[model samples]
Target: MSIPVITLGAVASAFVPGLEQLRGPVTVVRRCEELAELVAACQTGLARAAIIAPGAADLTASLVDRLRFTGVVIIALRDHPPGAADPVVDGIDYVEASVEPAVLAAAVSRAVGRFEAESARPRDSHAYADPLGLPDVMVPQPPDATEEPGTGRIVAVWGPSGAPGRTTVALNMAAELAAAGSSVLLVDADTYGASVGASLGLLDESAGLAQACRIADQGRFDGAALGRIAVSVAVKGGRLRVLTGITRPDGWPELRPAALGKVLEAGRSLAEVTVIDRGFCLEADEELSFDTLAPRRNGAALRCLEAADTVLAIGAADTIGVPRLVKALAELDDAVPTATPRVVFNKVRAAAVGRAPETQLREAWERFGPSVRISAFLPMDHAAADRALLAGTALLETAPASPLRLAIAALADVPAAGDTRRRRPGQRPRNVKFPGIPARLPR
Candidate 1:
């Protein structure tokens, strides 16, 4: 039987003669000039298998998602071999770009058989969102009482581009959750500015996140492996396991697609609460025709939100920050509707929004997002925050009874339905190094 195919590359037209040599009626009938045209062909069900080159237009996760929805298998032609060191993302199969015509045909034939088998079976719930079926990092609360216990909670602490104390909240949240006798893993996932280590006084320059991502890229990231990368920090009642972000600014590419999620999945087995301090950018810039699995700084943050059981969408109290937060809320809803966010206002003061700041901020946010109520407003605590940062420790340790610590502790008290007793602080499951790092935080 014949198979339908679409070709997209600079020398795409030259491949027609080669495709015609297939023993079966293999048709390279459609040649897409632009990404839009290729997408259109896939939408109309004209393209079955796309033979795409390394740099064929802007191939984004969103586009790959679209193709997967319409039952299109992506056959990527790269200069490298398919193995542990390959730079390919999920949702696409890779073959050597310089392969002979006959070898290419074999790949296409396999793609057809794989597609037919997959299409015939019941559709996967995550087929369109994450077609590659990379490990489902999400540990959703068990629907019934019979569901698994001790599944950790993922709380993504995110906010707008302008500084709104996301790291502070994340650290405080981890501390509070730890104080409640839950093991915590605080991850610095803010690709734009990774300050969790510095805030906690850790100066080891280990680039823990980059190393974990490297291991994941090699497809050897499991729970045992995850334990090796984490640095232990004693909080209060329980310990805080930290996964430091990239060592440098341009190191975002180190965190490839599905890598961070694999780390999160691994962390769940060790911790009771996972606090991911995410970057400000939630935008999915999949419009670039690069590889569908291209390295994106914001992609890590997006995945954190996707896998989170609770999303703390925070923002600054005043003028510019409030407006950005409002716009961000709408974008968040459009992007990850599965994540039900709890809105928070950081650095709230009467001077920022005048008397009755909460009421005014609520009134302003109600226009754009009527259903999203301002759940909590963190008060301005300069002295306590400064002391914690300068001391290279958590606010709870510096000022245990401070208002800031109390506020975060209140948030930690939010009921978790399917939780079991967790380990205490300073309990090292994997003993690699000593406890704690001397942090340097930015004001």
Candidate 2:
């Protein structure tokens, strides 16, 4: 039986005549003039493979992912070698447009064979496998046979909405770790409001994290590639490797969970501690409304939490902030039951609670919050925070003796057990019970 194929665009049309002439291995089932028609044809199960031109309308990474999800192989015909001007799409096989019909047929057959093999294999529940079945072409191997790969600790800084000092905590913690001679990679994964670049005085508009995700989605992510994309910022104690977040909110689709997960994996091999500043929302409502394969806006934050060795759940100290944090903690427990986040209350002050604030806050937490323990309380220091913000640096750099800085530095001492218990790629995190909270909180 001949394998059915669809062709799109003028370049793809030129090959149809030759492909039909040699009809033993494959057959041209349809010739689509536009991307929409090609997508429709593929969705109807009319073809197993699509030969698309590079200039196909609305041929984005998301579209490519959707097409691949339908069990269709995409062969993108490239007019020339990929460069900065014309980058390669993530989940497509690029073949030289001038290749002969025989070569194209063989390529399609090989791709199909590999796809079938991958589909038959049992997939890991925690991570998504490359849709294209591409090998890890650029993964760095350890030099000595006896030496193990670097298993850096992943610390994710998360919080509820209303500016609860997530970025402030993440930046200082990473700086302190770096100051203590540990290599650190600070990633700004906040899709909604990405200000890590501007916060640290990095004026460059390049979306480092997005670029890394694209490289990761292509199965070519490595420590070297990460280094190339990330910018180095020198701090008081040491320098930090920073991966800035997306410049625009619409770029959330670029930070797919699967790709971001791979980037975190590579980050472990690159640094001693990887600090990620995550977004506020954890809701996966998109999953309920859209297909299982749709791009999730909050998937990036959830994925970071899942991969994190330690989760620093930050919240403000005010009346509104405390309740928000408590509610968010319950949601966090439901989202990733295995995650035991270290609760941190930022901007803590006597005014927020009564005099003797720590004692009052503790009593309230025990009554209203889940059974999780409070990790640290960062006192509100507006002057110090302002200085750091104005200087575009961490508190350690601006005011080392500030009370808030001291509090944030102490958080660095928390052990990262993930270094020792490195979960295998795509392996689900083992279920570890939270001390007091039940597996599922009352909704």
Candidate 3:
């Protein structure tokens, strides 16, 4: 039986006549006029492979991944020599447009053969499974012997709405971690409002997180690739690597949950600790209303929370903020049952809760909030915050002596297991305990 193949793009169509001449190895089933038609043809199971031009309309890494998920072997026909300027599309084989018809056929056969061989292999029962239930995606490799255990801990900074300082906490925490001599990768995973690049005084034009997700979706993510995409920011004591988030909200479809998971997996090999600044919403209503395969706007945040080793749930210190945080905590618990977020109240001040705000807030929390203990109370330091924002630098650099900076620095002292770095002499440790926070709230 001849292998059935579909062709798209003008460059690909030019080979149809030649391909049809050599009928034994492969057959041209349909010449699609557009990407949608090609996708539809592949979905109908009429084509085992698709040969598309690199310039096809709306061609993206996400589309390539979707086609591959349907078991369609993709071959890109390039009319020019490969160069640094050429866009790298992962998860697809490339063939020169000038290649002979026989050679093209051979390339398609080889790709299909490899795909079949991989599909037939015995599955590993203990391997990391895709929580999204995606098929044929690459399984992340296990840590090598040289890597220290528990080194690459993912700490996601999440908070309820009303500007509870999620980015502020995430950025400073990452800087503090780096200052302590640990390699850090600070990722802006907030699709709705990504400002890590802007916050650190770096160019926000390139969407580093989205680009990383594209590479990860193709199963090509590695330490070197991560290093290339991440911008290095020099902190006071050490340098921190950062992956900026999407430039626009419409780019959310690029940050699929499955790909984000892979990106986090690869991050373990790149940095000792990965701090993700997450968005506010955790609702999955899109999944309920649309097709199972439709993109969910809040999926990225939920995925990060689920994969985080530690979750820093921040909330503003006020009447409205406290109630919102309480409700959000319940929503988070329902969304990710395994997550135990360290509750943090930002902008804690006398104006918000009246005299001795910490005392009153703690008392009220004990009575009304979830059973989880409050981890940290960041004082309202509008001047320091404004200074840092104006300078486009972390508090560690802009206002090192600010009370807010001191609080974040203290939080970083509670290191991962096996981390024995001692605090500077005379630096007092904050009275915060991590053991009491229950994984699930009481019924």
lDDT of 2 at 170: 91
Best by lDDT: 3
**On lDDT, who's better, 2 or 3?**
3
The ten-residue window of minimal lDDT in model 1 covers 434-443
Tell me the spans in candidate 1 whose CA falls farther than 4 Å from its real position: 1-150, 287-293, 367-369, 414-443
Considering summed lDDT, which 10 consecutive residues are worst modelled in model 3?
434-443
State each model's CA lDDT, in order.
Answer: 0.69, 0.75, 0.76
Q: Please provide, for model 3 over 192-297, each residue's C-alpha lDDT reduced to its tens digit, 9 standing for 90 to 100.
A: 8998887876644667788777656645556666766676776666778788899686787778788888888767778888999999999973653323346666
Tell me the lDDT of candidate 1.
0.69
Model 1 scores a TM of: 0.60
- In model 2, state the lDDT of residue 236: 58
TM-score of every model versus the real structure: 0.60, 0.69, 0.71
Query: Taking the tens digit of each residue's C-alpha lDDT, what string does model 2 give over 219-314?
Result: 556666676667677665477888889978567777878889998988878887899999899987465332443567789889999998888899
Which runs of model 3 end up more than 4 angstroms from their true locations?
A: 1-5, 8-37, 40-49, 52-100, 103-151, 285-293, 414-443
lDDT of 1 at 180: 64
Model 2's number of clashes is: 0
Question: Model 3's lDDT to the true fold?
Answer: 0.76
